[model samples]
Target: MAGGDPHALLAAAADQMGKPPEGTPRRPRVGVDLGTASCVLVVLDSSDEGDCPVWVESAGSGALQDGVVVDFARAVATVRALRDRAVDALGTELSTAATAYPPCIPVADARACTYVCETAGFEDVTLVDEVTAAQRTLEITDGVVVDVGGGSTGVGVFRDGRLERLDDRPGGGHHLDLVLAGALGVETGEAERFKRERPTDALPILTPGLHRIAESIRAMTRGTDADLPLHLAGGALMIPRAGDVLAQYLQRTVVTHPHALLITPLGIARSAP
Candidate 1:
């Protein structure tokens, strides 16, 4: 059995923060995140303390189309492109890479994630579930960890250090953009920019959208809400007032991270063998 430090990998991937010094290893571990909006690749200089993410790179990709590999050749080429760029950044060849899939995906589709890495020329591949990967970074013992991606929100509730509930509901950043677009009569991209830049002012306007997400969380945590806290680990809800809004909606404590988007991808790297 083998395990790598998902936490340290995440920390270092985000500029080597909170990691032990790099150590000698056979080779650096590479990770690729096939996201809906972008495809990201990360390299970790693995050690006993954990693999330190030495480099991170991403490219805009519409090929995956909401976490599913709709266009196989496009997805593979995207992965390869990101892989080559990351290898160049780290000055090493990426022979082995780890990738992740969203929760509840079928085996065949999950295998596609590995195939993407394999097609990218990695001899070794590791596959991790997106929610479990996020936990590697959050280390949530007893509570819910919600990952709000552009198209869906995946929730995992843990009780006494074990996951008790898991589910996914579609409503996230893109949904918020839709709400903003309708209200302001702006394009989705413009609304996305507005929501990101002026989130403080956009909070009240986006309340229903946030509540929709909160309600989804409530639905996911119905059985476990007795005393469990809610820990948010995703990019879509990174807006400043999101946690506060969710806390008020759920009538429970909500935890937010400094850089939520990197949590799961880094966690996936940590899950490498």
Candidate 2:
């Protein structure tokens, strides 16, 4: 990775989401994210300039729950499909990759993420907590990184580029979808689609759920400096005006990046050894 604007890197990653970039990959760096509501795979090629994204792919499959691999076969199948597509596009076999688990999941659950990657065909896999992975991309030296994924929110406090405190609790996008579902008298899937497509309307309905997440952040970062800005990572809080809701509720600075969903997956690629 190079010392450039992290947002630029995210924009680059976003542009290559579905389309494979031109040129053959060299020294490929790979990252797999087994998210609660989706699975994402990123491949980067290292050069003197920096790590450039080559291929990025994702699958909308709910194979995990709360950082645990609930459906082992489905998880493996999803990762394998992603891996196979990357191989087809890049014309190279990705033998090793890094992956992440939500912070504070049971050790066995975390290991299950690695196993899923291995079973999906990676010969070697590295495991990282989701918050640390997000830091790899944001490169925040002295602040907080909060990863609001599908199943849970993980908070990490950093000082001088070193992590000081880390914690996680269950409550995230899925819960918000549930709230929307109940309010609209619709099914979970419709609620999710509405939340994505009609976020403006959804924000009002989702405020309380966002507040609950804010309260979780408040409790988790209790001893840390309250002045450090809260950086929002992951896809859950990518909804428009979501950061404003959090900032108003927490009375603290909340920084939300564009293409926020790519934060962790991109960081995970940067983390690959």
Candidate 3:
């Protein structure tokens, strides 16, 4: 497995969005991430070294909240839009895809994620846990994978390439936006834009929220091995020095990546068979 330069793979994936590299595998695997703040579609080359993303697209969506499908119709529409965008960019009909849900959600709720893909015109859909999908992208054999998305933080502990424990809680970028909105006296949408575009300016105001997330991580991993480094895989913690804040707060090793948000989505595509 390629271990020395994970960030390079992530950067390559980001750079290839909407324009896949030439000579990529003809039959690409697809992943649909129905997230709380956005829906992402990822296509990856189907080959021995297929982990790199070929095309990726995301659309802001309120269809899901905290990993649950809240607005079913909007969810389907968002996935359909993402699918169409990928098809247009890749020039191929994407009929099958893999999607994921937060760990420990009810089976029915998780099936709802698969149904979103099926409704969006996918003929074959595979459902995987979000954290495992992240591991597929990070390729971490023994560490904690913490997926901090827009609405939730999912923690998965793996030992020897096997998942040992999985848990999720209600807190993420959305909550941080709430904090920023309140602090800056701006609308939530404005807060989101500011959080992304002016993250450095917003980080000081958002530190408390980030610490809350760290506390959630500490709680989730209470009984797990403390020595395992925390590998972050989601957009919520992409701010500069956010990893340092987490490390300082938890006093544990924390690993982060560029385009952290795409980790789970790309892994979902890898989960496809």
Task: Give the candidate number with the greatest lDDT.
Answer: 2
Clashes of each: 1, 0, 0
* Residue-wise C-alpha lDDT for candidate 2, range 1-273, written one tens digit per residue: 433679888988999998956866889999999998899999989777888888889998799998899999999999999999899888888999999999998899999999999999999999999999999999999999999999999999999999999999999989999999999999999999998899899999999999999999999999777799999999999899999999999999999999999999999998897
- What C-alpha lDDT, on a 0 to 100 scale, does residue 167 get in candidate 3? 97
TM-score ranking, best first: 2, 3, 1
Q: Which regions of candidate 2 deviate over 4 angstroms?
A: 1-3
Q: Which is superior by TM-score, 2 or 3?
A: 2
Q: Which window of 10 residues has the lowest lDDT sum in candidate 2?
A: 1-10
Candidate 1 vs candidate 2, lDDT winner? 2
**TM-score of each prediction:** 0.88, 0.98, 0.94
Model 2, C-alpha of 268: deviation from truth (Å): 0.7
Lowest lDDT 10-residue stretch of candidate 3: 1-10
lDDT to native, each model: 0.76, 0.93, 0.88
Error of 2 at 164 (Å): 0.4
Query: In candidate 3, which residue pairs clash?
Result: none
Model 3 lDDT tens row, 69-172: 99999999999988887776667788989999998889999999999899999999999999999998888999999999888999999999999989999999
Model 1 TM-score relative to the real fold: 0.88
**Local lDDT at 69 for model 3:** 97
